[model samples]
Target chain A: MYKGYVVDKALLDKDPHFKAGCILCHAGNDGELSKEKAHLRMLKKPSDNLRSCGVCHKKTAANYAKSLHYTTIGQRTGVMPRFSEAELKTFDEKVFEKSCRSCHASCGDCHVKGAPVGGISIGLVAKHKFVKKDEGKTCAFCHGGRVYPEYTGDYGGAPDVHYQKGMLCMDCHKKAEFHGDGTAYKSKNEVPQRPACKSCHPQGKEAKKETQVAHSLHDGKVSCYGCHSGSAYRNCNDCHGGHAAAGPGMILGRSPRDRKVLTTLRLIPTVRDTFAPAGIKMEHFDAVPNYWDTPAHNIKKRTERTRKCDVCHVDRKNFLTKETLIKNGAKANEELIFVPKAIAR
Target chain B: MKNRRTFLLAFLAVWILALYGAAVFAATPNKCIQCHTNDALMKSLHKPPVLPKSEGEG
Candidate 1:
């Protein structure tokens, strides 16, 4: 009746989710009066199997099974470049399956209840009610460390313009992005319908001539976040043996994915010795840069760079340099360093 | 008159049996909720939080 296991009696008759009785999803001896007997074979998270919800939601369950959120293949793709064939095999068995894949979200995690992060849960989301979407309770728990906090401005500076306009994660990131479009994408970058600034704010649509000129000038040269990132976002450092340290920073640099484009970047936590604990020396450590281009969640309408062009073209502030790079990082990180040119007056 | 009396008696018997079945179905409580709804029972059953094996990505 209190926290984790409370079920509203009123919803028992009203909601179809409960009509089949708890035993249908959560297998247990409902006939037994003794507490221990009744809970003997009960499933703590029935949705972990997906079939529990799949019985009624066939299409969603089938698509979700291949979704990045459910499969968590993106984590493996990000780190695979650093590993050799044999090392990757070892990593898949030892680290990825045992650790990363455990983080995948199940049906109940978002709908019926909040997922258990770090073995702690918020319990039933609304007295066991099956909600369509509840970003605050569901998304916030997993992304609380960075994205959510950055979006809400709870980490440091003002909240994102989107958040100020009363938008949640699902507002921009559509349900199909979470539910999957029947493609087993290796990484989120390959997701076709993933949220992009250009999707909402197309170029040349700006009412102000100055804004239109700025967009036109920076079309392919600069990324939206390069100038719009409002404040310092979290940069994770040195993750080894499943532990990582994080710090706030605003790093502007050449995109690792495309050096021609300048954008906001964040320091990845992987280091040479990051996998050494698991006996992986990372034979190809330099293959991937330590700093990867990030779509910083803390976006603003006007930032220091937007207000004064001199901030970037003249002073070249926040631009990554060899001197500012993390010590003992991969040599590839040097490639991400970019220097801005002076503006023509 | 005899046939009419027999039909009435059969109708009453079937109705009584249906009511009995409905009562029995309604009385069968969901055992999961029976214990979970008890505040004191749940409080007593609560265990200490388990330590996480690893800190996952955000």
Candidate 2:
């Protein structure tokens, strides 16, 4: 049997997904003997159109249709602030619809086969089995660019504490997060079911008195990633049209979403000329900062900052400053620069 | 002898009908799997993945 296309003949009688025959979802001539005649107009990825899965899994399919993974509307929301009314219209038509929307994940991408990233795919998740969850193949393939690599320490220093404990993407991020609760949320931040560090590790639950004191002191002022980001994470620079060169570095700055809170920030590749190829000038380029708060995946039980308060309060290590800021970045970037005050003994 | 002959003819008819029913109405081997499961055929069709020139970070 072939590696990817091998289907266990035994499953034909057992699995209901296959009971209706391959023709039920993958529309093709099952009666045709020749390969050429059989695959004529076959839906290579039947679940691309949710109706294939929605026919059986009504609720999950209906919810997944509106999920951030499916709609990918967060991409548009991220840069919408920088566009003028006419520019927004142009971006919607040219850049977003053409480039960004293609990244949306379909139902089959996770359950049946791995989604193609940059035009390369792993073909099938298993031997054509409808797996409940295969984060290593599915999540790792799509998020491999940044998050997954960092989580596993392939991109940098020690692997995340959670990975060391054998936790995966689905551990914290539950099924409801992937299959929406019937809300057409524009950004993932708006999703009520999104994973938060505090959800699992509550503040007052620290084992040691020292740890408990630290958590209380920085509870609202600092984000968990601000101190726990293990090492340098990837930062993209100078994105033009749809391409950007990535580098390794970690930047701690005020959260662009909530400036009062300090958090791990990643440089967004959007520059003034980012949409120029599509004839967009991004008239209000200074409206949004180039850095955005990112929950860095390379978390550790003990980091340089966590080990010593001096890394932040005294040395102010990894903090974003005006000089370290990207040249030709938006003027709004200046607002994100923050200096941690020294602790008084 | 006539009774025995009649019984023999009925059995022959039943056997033939069963064979015809099995050929026409029984489950056919899934043609999709027939070619897909052939390793040699898939290997012959395999080509190196071509990376797209697009600006996707993932």
CA lDDT, every prediction?
0.88, 0.88
Clashing pairs in 1: none
Look at candidate 1 and tell me the lDDT of residue A152: 98
User: What lDDT score goes with residue A342 in model 2?
Assistant: 90
RMSD for all candidates, in order, please. 3.2, 4.3
Candidate 1 C-alpha lDDT tens digits along A1-345: 147677777888899988877898888888887878888888878988988889999999999999999999998999999999999988998889987887899998899888877777888888788998999989999888788999999998779999999999999999999999889999999999899998989998998999999989999999999989999999998755455788899999999989999999999888888888678889999888999899999999999999999999999899999899998888899999888888899
**Runs in model 2 with CA error above 4 Å?**
A240-243, B1-23
**Superposition error at B43 for model 1 (Å):** 3.3
lDDT of 2 by residue, A184-292 (tens): 9999999999999988898898999999998998989999999888889988877554547899999999999999999999988888898898889999999899999
